[model samples]
Target: MRSNASDCDVLIVGAGIAGISMAAHLQDKCANLSFMMVERRAQPGGTWDLFRYPGVRSDSDMQTLGFAFEPWDDDQSIAPGGSILEYLRGVIHKRGIADHIRTSTTVISADWQGDQACWLVSVEGPDGPEKVRARWLYMSTGYYDYDHPYDAQITGLESFAGTLVHPQFWPENLDYADKRVVVIGSGATAVTLVPAMAEQAGHVTMLQRTPTWMSVGPSRDRLARVLRRILPRKLAYWLVRQRNIRLFDFLYHAARRNPHMAAEKLSEGVRKELGDLYSPEDFTPPYNPWEQRLCLVPDSDLFKSIRQGKASIVTAKIDTVQTDGIALEGGEVLPADIIVTATGLKLSLGGHIKVSIEGRPVNWGEEFFYRGCMISNVPNLTFVFGYLNASFTLRADNTAAYSCRVLNHLRTSGTQIAIARPPADGLVEGEPFPFSSGYLMRDLAQVPKSTDALPWRLNHDYLADCRDFRRNGVDDGHLQFELAPRVTDQSPVADQPEMA
Candidate 1:
């Protein structure tokens, strides 16, 4: 048992993109606030560090994916995982916030005391089990669990003779040279793995239960490059970012409003790129576009692999896994030296940290999301949840800026705690995410929901979110503020060993 002398006004969980962005935004706008960042992983890069699979890259362009305060001056707009990790490390060093971070520190639980107006955060640090006090709590932990991934649960998987791998935990010494690989699922991971492994492998087959819509574009943004040559750096970056945002909005609206026309346009584009090798039925998905995330392939690499006969796509159901390969329901067997499962991620909230308010555990599922940042009836705590439609950083940036505003308001009003309250009229119920991604659907019940009312419904549209989070004031009737009640210091935490 150790006492933490370095108390903080705010204790932030996870030192990833969202956490770093939050720190930067607060520093630029609210430098006086004392905050500390804690990460369970030894490194700062979140997804970028975790995923080391072949051809791992961002689905969204770097112009939007990169922090708003920092310009992404990289050569490729669809950056590789290594480059993104490097960029995140550079930001932490450049900002001089490295010392403020405690790596390999996992938060086990947080208990909010209304009387003291502080949260007793139980964390496992390098030394041992420790207790830290913070006036407020901020969660930058991403939606997915780092320690566990979703299990596909295929029958007789252990009987397979081939090497089994998941993209979430790619082996460091993995070699695929001259190997016949079969990748399961048709999402972004499968598309990326197929093209990349095809380069060295004897052949690669993509087996999917259902096809996903894919879009191919140049890895480098030619317009951004041209603009940089003619205009100032800041101006060029702004223009490029805005252009991509508008284009994403237009395409999403088109897909939602006119599914048939949108499908026709997407199919025509893919058909022209692949020529006779592509079939509309095989490439087309049953659901409308944007129903699930659209996979992006850089420079038609996937199509190139298929055209060269290095890779092929098969839609089938797995009856069982044989010693040699997977047997299909349609009486076909796929022979493979290796099998990769790119199924999906397992969603986690607040890094699975248990939260209690005055001895009662928080029911996150029953709570309403207030501005997609703070949970309803939860005091002085905020979680950063991004937009699924646009680049995640866009919403992350907005959430950070909005949080800064709320913090400033609290300071001005001399309030130690603030909670989101339901209005006199009840909120209309709706799904947490408008989209139907498998991961989202599987964990929808556990997540917090938003309503149709203002400051409650999280519209994925970037422009609307920007206006609401940035321009709108925080003193709306939804958030109820209060000062702390007079109380003595908190009791000592129980003596326990640090989590191994």
Candidate 2:
């Protein structure tokens, strides 16, 4: 298609936070080894770049959302999409990781060649299909797919006359100002959108099938700003990062351990903030605060919007979509000039990419999740999965660090392929990993279910898992030190070669 497909020491898929962090860690630790990162998008910053909806901000604070090596310098704790994208771009440029990334290159399929002890990767690019062989394949493709949208089939959605938009594919030019906007869904996207659009929209209605626990905090951290002004930039960054980490950890742990008390406190807090304007019955979720993610309402902005009569909450199931508005199942029709589906996304493991070993298909559904990083039978592959309790980046950083350790171990032991095996006593099968219904139920038909071994377990207790993963090889057990002949070294390639 273009030129001869070149080989690499490691092949990384996805140029998102996970892939970028992995590449950075590998480059910093193993400078002698050459690796290439393949990203399907034209640029980096996967989710941040893709979702450009109004009021789209990180659910986690910016300090924690950012890479460990890079600290977010923005004044706001909950940074917007544009700021996060810029920060990621800055990190890539600062680290010079752009050189190692092959943009607009998609890995179609990967097959492990047992005899050669290498992975044969077939990729599609702008020019044509190309193939490469790598001793190690690291699937840093984030859990969710870029183009997939979770749109529930509404009965009369097609018949609606007004513009209907999904937060996933928000139109850049659509004007919400002076329009009676109705946002559907009760997740983070809807929470964020309702408040933001309410500021300008003629009237904004938050239409929710179910309520989600929403908590309010100051968008700008005053202490963080003060420290930034007084202390050195690096020191300020470290202090704020540590403080937020501890705070979030405590909150999440409390909620998980004492659900009843936590739920009461969260509900009381919301009631006090919104007073009579926010109906506790309609706004408060039945589940515990952290059972599902607690929606962050910066500075009680959403409540303020409600107080000002700019926004209203409507909890009802949509029976049908009328040409002028949405009809509730209870026979009430609400008028709206525009409808925004702030619905969640489809959960796809490894971007729905195909994986096979020695010509046999690897059924991910049947596979075990080993330490939430590697698949049971998947050899020489490590994925980037973050903590469910704390900020995802914190866990991602730990994953990157542990991956480095694993790589070093492999190099020292002359192990070309290492696969993690479940416990012999079958403890892995007995204790399936716990996950939220959103992920488990949303894509049940598509993704594999977590069995006892190699199950999808999210470690909310951040430090414990971080220490365990970093020090311990694998939680249950790992098939370590599978030796193979080394690949023949080719000519040293230039760092910044143009992508074919």
Candidate 3:
């Protein structure tokens, strides 16, 4: 509803799951709206495309992780990375929004123009840098840094005469056949790599400072397979999706509310899988369940590998990176021909884009997370920060629905600017995001602040958020609308040309 013309009505900044979901929502609900999606990578799939490491897969099930509009037709709920990438690509093509996306284009900066009531976005395409005006900006650029990962700081890493690899930048065809591999860190990546590399490697060892809680799950959903046979495809998908969403939401809340029972239940699963191989020092984590996500081992692959004598786990502090392998603090050396550093990702907010309001820079850390959607006092910008406990696309789908609501409101009400006003009454500060993962904890100061008040907290409960959004609606008095002077049929953004 900007008085001034814009290049597009809504400009999506990434072509990932989140961005594609927004596009689908717009395509279905607001068909006439002009929108464009820009992806830095040549491909549409974000994390799925970026991460190509061994045994790469989703920890969360594809049932709820996949978009609401699209039914994940695969039998394997805990799918491989390739399957996920294909599903994501299919969503855009099936929805006929492939033409709305521009690949190999990066959003460098976005500045809000108050006078024109639009965002002047700077993008670096293949040719050169260009600026475009948009009524709104949606950032789906993900939580982690694309180019770099968090440094593991492995001492004498360079001195070792071995193939050193990080999961982020997985090299092509660098064969490790029959090679002795030592994968550092006990996170999900290490759990995945140990078993995967164990298939062909002489032996694979998972080295960890502290043990992580592990759970056993099947890759294929047995009930989903049964339902698919009896019910229609779409209906089956919906039922399966809902079942998974509720199950995960329940488990996450249960873990937090009753950490003791949850921890015991989770450990029991591991003990059952490993049996004689189970050791308290190797499987028991110091932290409570959901403190850090319990790593999933589909079909007990990690445990199977250990039982089969193909892989093993060593719990000790890494003392140094020796010439042949890694040295432990207890003077034990682990021989390795290859070292895989599965040390987590680096969290980056707003895709590290320099955001400004006309000439003034915006400090995102100072802002409060308004209704877990928009940042406080920020106008026409929505960022998708997914759940730590549940599937990511659950939030992506919900965010798109909420975004459409805002867009519809703006068009119908004839408003130019819609911003989340900072809390008026004195509200005490709350936790920003309650996740205890090292990656998130390291960069806690970079994200927005949270408050004790309702609609001010950075919520993790998707079920609560979805219900609240549907029941309460957009006009909560916190999100203020501006420049509602006239009733005119003029649309600021003309229809976009097929993503050129």
Candidate 4:
């Protein structure tokens, strides 16, 4: 530890579900280690806290999304944002993880101090800027950029006469009641907002250039409820979680294997819900199912809204944003008092933090992922990487467990640093996630290169990843562990050096 710096065994950034899960795992597995979680926002619930748009809910099931350590026992598998936030808060208090969280603190940068074998993390808090040292840096910061969402460049956007809101930064109390609302974009946010705002607004219209695949399912999991009634709590959770994983995997794989068949089934579902109201042109997507994220509408809320004539869908290209309304390419004007931009989010890796190895900045695109946990050649830093197709927490739990294993291995081996050394021709130019969403496509090159094989590849298969991490122990010979350089001078200058 450096003489001038306060030291912690682990420094976790982002107090979201991932960060909280990691903290819980660390406490359970590495009892002797000291750790702290820093949240950029004033509150702790990450996504749940930030996104306050009406009808905000989880796209994934709670059985799979919830941490295995602290299982969600709710009957509703598809939970509302407030419910999920409450669940996270409950987990924090129950696990005594609240004390470790430092809110309203932004981690600006993390620089590796080679001499002292620690990360000098620069963070901006309410008081001011300060620096702290950590032996290992665990990043749970999500992929999206918090400060800036994806800027959807719409022509004549400044000509809007009414309130323009982005779902990312929803206004506190803007009266949309009796106002004709037009939500642009057919993504998850738009799907959620349409039905929610339709109940109150005069009329709600979903304006999209392209249609997205939507799936409808029951709000509560019947199987999970039955199992919970018959089996033990932990056993019920485990069983339901595994079943959901297999079901999700099967559906995703089936959709890819037989896209036409899968598309028909999805279309049938819409027809069942909307009946005569379902328009083939408006409801059907151009691409195959699971090509992009499939929007989930619990209990056909969106369809119900449409059937009741509260909401409507307009599948057309926007010609321009007029002061009174949006003009379509075919000269159709849609009157809207409020325009909601439910476009997408911008990708930012490592929470937009400037990460450097002893003053040398890391090029993530050039590096390979070490079992989807750590970056290759980057020492003493692990990440909580989640899955794209499946529930994020499934992989987050696995990554947390793997990180703990690495921590234990280091402690047992008396090593100060652990770096993953990639093999020759390791950097293969592949997609980080196979999804072709516009937001993901825009910044694909900014993230790490995908490898072709295990230990380096960030595979989307949760089951395969789980098996590999379990079977392949820490001593795989790929990781190089070394004792840090001894600082004999004990001077602050010798410990922390500026980038050359």
Model 4: worst 10 consecutive residues (lDDT sum): 491-500
lDDT of each: 0.86, 0.77, 0.86, 0.87
lDDT of 1 at 6: 55
Q: Can you list the residue pairs that collide in candidate 4?
A: none
lDDT of 2 at 191: 88
| Candidate 4 residue-wise lDDT at 67 | 90
- Per-candidate Cα RMSD to the true structure, in Å, reads 4.4, 4.3, 3.6, 3.7
Residue-by-residue lDDT tens digits, candidate 2, 1-500: 43338788788887878888888888787765678889898988888878888888988887788877776778999888888889888888988989988889888889888766778889998878988888778888877657777768778988889989998888988888899999988888998898889878999999888898878788888888899899987888889888888888888877788988887887887888878775766777766677677888888888888889999899999999999999999999989999997777777877767889988988876766666666777888877766655677776677776667767776665456678765576433333324364754676555433453223443456766666665656423455556543333442222212111
lDDT of 3 by residue, 244-296 (tens): 88988888888889999998898889888889888889988888888888788
Model 2 TM: 0.92
lDDT of 4 by residue, 362-432 (tens): 88877888898888999989887678788888878888888888888888776677899977655555557
In Å, residue 427's CA in model 4 sits off its true spot by 3.8
Best by TM-score: 1
Candidate 3 versus the native: TM-score?
0.95
| Model 1: how far residue 113 lies from native, Å | 1.3
Backbone clashes (count) for model 1 = 0
Compared with the true structure, the alpha-carbon lDDT of candidate 3 equals: 0.86
TM-score of structure candidate 4: 0.95
Question: Per-residue lDDT for 11-125 in model 1, tens only?
Answer: 8888888999988987898888888999989888888988999999998999999998888888799999899999999999999879789998999999997777788889998
